[model samples]
Target: MGPETLLPNGIAHYLLGGLLIGAGTVVIYGATGITAGASTFLESTLSYVSGLPRFQQFRFTATRDWRVVFTLGIVLGGALYGLAFGEFGWTTDVQWWRLLGGGVLVGIGTRVGKGCTSGHGVCGVGSLSEASLLNVSVFVSIAVGTALTVQALGVSP
Candidate 1:
């Protein structure tokens, strides 16, 4: 089955979102000469959060405050989209603690993986980087395995 039935909107709606993201990626690269990646943005935000001068000296955040703005825009865009769709409800079937725990694990995994799926799968692979190709392979394999394992265990997460 196609995503049309599973999604709240038509395929065109999803396509538009993809197009917008692609345009944004191009714009970011054109403006900053840097491929946009969310994880690195978060890492920089964390550096600022920790209030450590050493973290601020890191190559990631040393000269890239715009990344933090880009990250905030991403988050704000998501919130605005949900509000626009009138589907802004956040009543999840999963427990809060489970969600928090999962978020922590994902954060850890992103650091260990050196980037998130957006970095490796979207930008890196698009750039034809071999390391990103390998990372995407491992990421997809593990994600598929996890989904299948959850299905086997009848877990709803």
Candidate 2:
């Protein structure tokens, strides 16, 4: 196969998306002194409905508003993109129950890991945080292993 066929189309779109995410992360930190991580934002948004002290901490409550807005922006942005120019349907053959189970496992993993990839990979790694670096390394290693194992098991999706 030629080099042109080796790469997917819309490569520029991916580049632009990455740049925008990085820019948004920087702007969020520069303006509000908060790290723009989705998992933390998810936790902070729980402050409104949950009475749990873990979600009611000063750090989460103090910046919950903007975090909520940021989270909304992420959801809306993806929706907008799909509405504008993309396959606007669920094309995956994966079952809803499997998806739900995977999401639950991911949520638990994030809590145990203390953060998600966006926190450790984007903001933390950008700032050269040791803990973030370590977390990201483990994240990548596990992800690679999981993908390989699934592929070996003939999982197709």
Candidate 3:
């Protein structure tokens, strides 16, 4: 395979993407003192339809409007990228149920860990939070171990 097959946009695309994420994270935090976490963004969106006290918390309800915009940006960004780059549709043969199960486990992990990777790894670590540092370590270790274990078990997509 050629470099194009491996990295269509080359290293510059990855570098630019990381820079954009960092800059956007910095800008959002600077503007509102809020970390750009997908999990919390999702929770905030729930406030619009769910009356649960957790969802109705001042933090989620008060800022949900902008959170919705942020969430939409995430979705639209991927959609636009796919449309522009011809990368749409499923690329893996993994079963849908397995994907759903994995998502459910990740959701639980976010709750138990008290934050997702973006929350802990990006914002929390940037601010030098000890918990975030530890959480990111655990996340990375578990991810690596899981991949190894799956490969050992002869798992396929």
Candidate 4:
């Protein structure tokens, strides 16, 4: 993109994006005062068990025990945000079998790809990682193909 396109009201869009991400991180930290990434939590847990000297004790404790509370806050925050945006709703007619299958597929895909959409699409892409780029490309392509397949199968909306 050109400089002109990148600039919004005399401020760079990239700068704004960075500021927004930084603000989110700060908000999470202010609310919980801990890093809020799943990968970091997993790594910290592994390090705690593996007897890694480089892994600080406080980091391990902060991640392992408090992650549940942190995650709950994230969910609550998302729900509140959705409500504010008028996107909050309750669905009582969900297909449990389909949901189970979809969950299994997502779990397997996350394992195979080494990350979920938040990890790869948000964090990885933001950090300009090549693996994230490839993973996202595969994910997008597969998603499109799946949508096409489902449509072809005449699935009801």
20-63: candidate 2 lDDT, tens digit per residue = 99999999999998777778877788898999999899988998
lDDT of 3 by residue, 26-140 (tens): 8888888888877777778888999899899998888998878877887898899999989899888999999999999989888899898888989999899999999999989
For residues 12-125, write the lDDT of model 1, one tens digit per residue. 878898888888888888987877777776657667667777567666676458887887898899899888887677768988898899788878877888888777777889
**Higher-lDDT candidate of 1 and 3:** 3
User: Tens digit of lDDT per residue, candidate 4, span 13-127?
Assistant: 4677567656765566677764335544555556656776665566665566666555566688768868876877665464778878987787778768887776677767766
Lowest lDDT sum, 10 consecutive residues, model 4, at 34-43
User: What TM-score would candidate 4 get against the native?
Assistant: 0.59
Q: Measured by C-alpha RMSD in angstroms, how accurate is candidate 3?
A: 2.7
**Range of the 10 consecutive residues with the lowest summed lDDT in candidate 1:** 55-64
Tell me model 2's lDDT, rounded to 2 decimals. 0.86
On lDDT, the candidate that comes out on top is 3
Which residue window of length 10 is worst by lDDT in model 2? 2-11
Q: Residue pairs in steric clash, candidate 4?
A: none
Q: Arrange candidates by lDDT, highest first: which order?
A: 3, 2, 1, 4
Go through the candidates in order and give each one's C-alpha lDDT: 0.80, 0.86, 0.88, 0.70
